[model samples]
Target: MNNLKYSICFISFFFLFLMSMMSMMFMIYFIMNNMVIFLEWEVITLNSMNIVMSVLLDWMSLLFMMFVLLISSVVIFYSKSYMSSEINLSRFIILVLLFVFSMMLLIISPNIISILLGWDGLGLVSYCLVIYYQNLKSYNAGMLTALSNRIGDVLILMVISWMMNYGSWNYIFYLDFMNNDLVMMMISFMIIMAAMTKSAQIPFSSWLPAAMAAPTPVSALVHSSTLVTAGVYLLIRFNILLIQSNFLKILLLLSGLTMFMAGIAANYEFDLKKIIALSTLSQLGLMMSILSMGFPDLAFFHLLTHAMFKALLFMCAGVIIHMMNNMQDIRFMGGISFYIPFTSLCMNISNMALCGIPFLAGFYSKDLILEMTSFSNLNLLIFMLYYLSTGLTMFYSFRLTMYLMVNDCNLLSVFNLFDEDYTMLKSMFILLFMSIVSGSFLSWLMFNYPYMIYLPFNMKMMVIYVSLLGGFMGYIISTMKIYSVNKFLVTYNLSNFLSLMWFMPYLSTYGLNYYFLNFGHNLLKNIDLGWSEVYSGLGMFNVIKKYSMMYSVYQMSNFKIYLFSFFLWMMIILIMLLIGL
Candidate 1:
């Protein structure tokens, strides 16, 4: 059985790698030749209109598929080592493969029906993965994740039903029709909402962190590339419709706030995996906001680059977590660089890449995004969100670094920590290389010409200045002072509110749920058992029984009085007859 599982993992890794290479080749061909292939198979005809299943093969789709495959390939390989102790290793591997397949289906399809299939697949498989540990936290997290994504699934279903007016579900073909028709554009709103829920933006953002209850390998895959990015990818495909729509502005505001919110929240987070998860959420916001600003390409660029490094970061964290005996608190982790230098080095590199350090994978995409933001004629709110979020990214990244690398060892004097797992290192090395180089490689390959930007020197350097300031603040804040009072205690409530993702989880879970459940309980008490009983069957039966009993007693006690009354009535009638005569 063990040998069979190993073979399954190996076969999956090889198959994914092969597919990735093929996807890249196709992506390049499609790009060079400026080509797209659309294949449609007619499923049925109604009212002289065809319902067809369609596949869209183009540069963008192929490129995204390539990245997804590459990441999944390495992730599956990484899991072989990371999940080695698990009894159901083969099942886990198969679930990951199914997830990648779903994503691929989503990437290639032009029809909303096909998209729904893949979208639902992702949600279902992810729930399985999240609840894999069979614990309360995992179960709760899985429920949140599944139900949150189900919102998107429902919205897509609505979109499909609405699209029926056009006699087709191929969204790519009818984007223009929907763009011109006001009533049709309502689908765009639903689409945006669906995407937001899937991406976990703003009000729907609680599930992303909750999802960290999954295995680290799943986190590395889902948070970084496949699951979360599906929403961004969907929007990217629909960018043409959004570019001219008024709803894009709303998306921009929400995405910016999401970016800012996640950034601030991460600074207050202590769980190592959750910090990275929040960072993923922040970057997702960046992608979404940029896409909303009418640059799907930049969003796509950042999405790809982010997938590389963020996956590496999670893999590194998994190694650390594994070594730390499942301890995810950064407070308990400090100065293990000496023990596991390779893992530490990889983590630092991924963290720096996350901070958008110069010339690294992130810089190539992140710097471009900020420059584009500066160039665009956006409002002050959005402008501040962009820069402030950038600084907070650095702040949290450095704080994390200090806690994990710079500070004194907080663990016991003796512990075994080493980077000797060659399988894990090999997988990390693939992502580590990609994390360093994928940004520049993709930028050069994807863009034939550079964007023109004329910015003042101060504005151009704003990212650097903020990054340095954030780094300084992060270092200072993480530093412990024995004599100093705890600031978090002084501002306890405020800290809790901010740290707990603005109580979003409660709002999404218990807040709304409590009210709804309370309403049901009230109905049970008042209507089902209270007023309903009084007005209907049981209460009415009691009333009728009481009245019947009262009449029976009156008849039984007053028989003689009744006879006398009858005789008096007859006598009065006879006297009236005589008078008439």
Candidate 2:
């Protein structure tokens, strides 16, 4: 009976493992032969317009699918232990598998219709996963998460409409031809908007943090690997069209801001999962910004590596939260390594990789990205945002370590601590191993011929400088108690502004609807219920009837004949002339 809980995990892991192995095999063959497989099944054709289902197979899709399957396999294995106590364990695994399927559809589709199918599926499935716990927090976060992605869904639908002008919904075929077309301008703008919402860029980022209300496995899968990266993946596939555009410039700016703001927000966050969620936001910004820099390959490289470690980080957080009775407040968690050595080991490595520590999965991609940014012709603001965000990455990584490792035991009771679950630890170790090696493996595999980098020692030192400052700040911030200093209390306003994510959550959700809602209320009060009625049949009749009754009173009083006759000729003439005209 107990073994039944692992049935879904076992099947999913076995299937994904086989898929990953096959994808890897195809990846090698495609790289050597430069081969692609294209399959299309027409859904309908009317008046020379076509909508079809498609599958595009190439080195990129194969490689991405390989990683996706690999990660899903590991996550499913991990969930066996993570969700063992839940009655509906099979349902949770099915949702995860469904998410993986949606991602797969997205990864391979060359048709816009198929893309939307996958895109909407991701949003829908993720919403279900987010609100799985059936609580108010989960429900609200689920709505936010669902609605934010729906914006992308809507934009894609609009793109489908606009693309109808081209007589085809397969965007891949039109990328190079439509690069300079005037009609493409709207399409490009909509695409960027869609990508921004899915990637959780500025003003659309509230959902990412709020989505932490989901179970940890959902967080690891949705935030770290599949759902969020779908936008970046879409952009990557459409890179030829987007490479030369002002939209990319705007995207570059927003991505930089997202990275910077999310990093700062993470430094102030107390909830462990929320902090990790914010960190994922910061990294998403990095990928988007780099992709905007016209290097989708590098961006994709980082995306794969970030997935490995970030998933591991969340899994570790899940383990900690589970151990601490599902309490995710980092303030109540201190020196936990003393209790769970294995979990702590995994957590520290993941945190280190997240900071782009040398020789780790993050190092290969992150260091390359920073160097590339430095070499680009960027304005001062963007340059600062990138560097500062990088430092903040290190800062928060250090801060998280301090809170979870360096402080005294902060748990309410020590007797409840346990981390001996092999099911969970086994799943985590798989990701941990990947986190250590995935960057190096992926870098060598993707870029067998390395590009040359020419720069002075000072120019190269920028990342190091920011990282050191960030680490120092993280130590100080995490080590110092918030109530310990009077100065911190004095600067509460400024701190609160940054801490509350610059009120971005408020701005994106309630703030966005406030004006529209107020306008609707005013319309209902003054227009629909008031002036609309007055202009309608009964009200208008009442108005005319009152005037007519007054005139009747005058007529009855002998002055009526004179008063009516005074205005009758001109008014009657005007009405007769209007009717005749």
Candidate 3:
């Protein structure tokens, strides 16, 4: 009976996903006819302070919605089998449905408030799913992710409050008000902070690696495709505002630092999942840096290609881990190609794509980013940092692939090659197809007459050759086991510095909390504690004495006690009012 209910819920969610995609597709067609001018709708609604429900479609949003639907469908189907063996199947299905519903809402939100609502919902449901294992470490990781995301959400809320105070809560209002440089800069900074935290940039990134404790399918879903991508989607959605802000340079710097730092961390990890987790951060940093250059089209292209390859890597890794009895550390994996040829081949294809080998998806997207950086007005030092990080990306991509598949003395002896469940292999093959084909399809679409000029870089033979050399150099270095202490010193410390940058935002948050606490204390100082005295008169002494040993540590002077008593009374009143008492 419970299984029947779970099946019904799953089917319902599947139907909703289809309906949402169809609606978005209709919007795309409507926009192509020029029936909807998004800019005009934004301006008109700005002048009239009314919330508009009209769909104003654009290429980027449409593309993002398409990927969202694709990833969600795959995840939902994968979850059916992944969860079937669990006892609490109904609860798991509900959480999965909630995640999909929230993602759809996020993709379609037309305003900042609606976007934030969806963002918060997605974060909340993702946390629940991460802790679905109901173990200590999973719960800890979920709590940490929740705490960091909550900080970001509150920052966004503050930005919204600032916008509302300035009378610009809609995109139309932003068009009118963005001319004020100060307001635009502040909003841009806040939005970037929200994006960085959500995308697991720098210090906030530890939670992502920790999240590998989740079920393999959940990792494939949240880490590879949907939830983390929301950050990049938000940045793309507000590209116009970002372009106007002076913060683009800062965004570029942060992205470079994040990429270099995460690349170093990836090198130090032995766990296969954690290596991929760190690589995701580095790759995302690369994408964000590219987007920071005001090229939405290139950024989205990279995003699309990255999704394909990253998903393939994670799913194939899952298959291997499952085959080997859930052993994920690379130290215990070796010569896997001999046993699971199909899985190894799929991983190698993804590895080549990830490292940007010539003619692959990564070569197309990453080479464009590198070429764009060369033309930017950014300092040469910054450019070199990104260049060096790209080399590291190639290095670790080779390290992960070789350490698992190649026949070496250090390789584990007891590796298994077969995936008993064909479901996993089928998912892997689908991703493999996408990884190989997406780049050419996108290149064809954008290189045609109408959009040709918008193509940022020439996909020439020279660029491909250089990228392939970089990747091959990395592979050779890994295979030869070259030990360079100088490389270690520079890269490792850079990562620490980037990780330390997270403290700035955290310190800001702490100061804000302290100020609010102080203000609350001051506001409650004049309140009387007469009710507290009354309650204390009724056997309260006996109650206190019963726990005197524990209460002793909390005891304070008479004035402090009076302040605490007054604050307690005020809280009770506030709670009463909030609950409509």
Top candidate on lDDT is: 1
lDDT by residue for model 1 over 1-581, one digit each (tens)? 88888888999999999999999988899899999999999889999767778999998899988988999999999998899989999889989989998998899999999999999999999999999999999999999999999999999999988887887688898776567686468888888999999999999999999999999999999987899999999999888887778988999999999999999899888899999999999999999999999999999999999999999999999999988888898988999888888888899999999999998899999999999999999999999999999999999999999999999878756766765599999999999999999988999988989866789999999999999999997888789522122364557677677788889999999987899989999999988899779889989899999999987875787678678768999999999999999
lDDT of 1 at 141: 94
lDDT of 2 at 353: 93
Backbone clashes in candidate 1 total 0
TM-score (all chains, Cα) for each model: 0.89, 0.88, 0.76
Order the candidate numbers by lDDT, best to worst.
1, 2, 3
For model 3, the local distance difference test gives 0.71
Candidate 3: clashing pairs of residues: none
**Candidate with best TM-score:** 1
Stretches of candidate 3 above 4 Å error?
A: 1-55, 166-168, 408-417, 446-581
Q: What is candidate 2's local distance difference test score?
A: 0.90
After superposition, candidate 1 runs with Cα above 4 Å error: 43-51, 412-414, 481-490, 521-581
Candidate 2 vs candidate 3, TM-score winner = 2
Measure candidate 2: CA RMSD: 9.5
Query: Relative to the unseen true structure, what is the Cα RMSD of model 3?
Result: 12.8
lDDT of 2 by residue, 158-190 (tens): 999999898778888899877889778888888
Stretch of 10 with least lDDT, candidate 3: 451-460
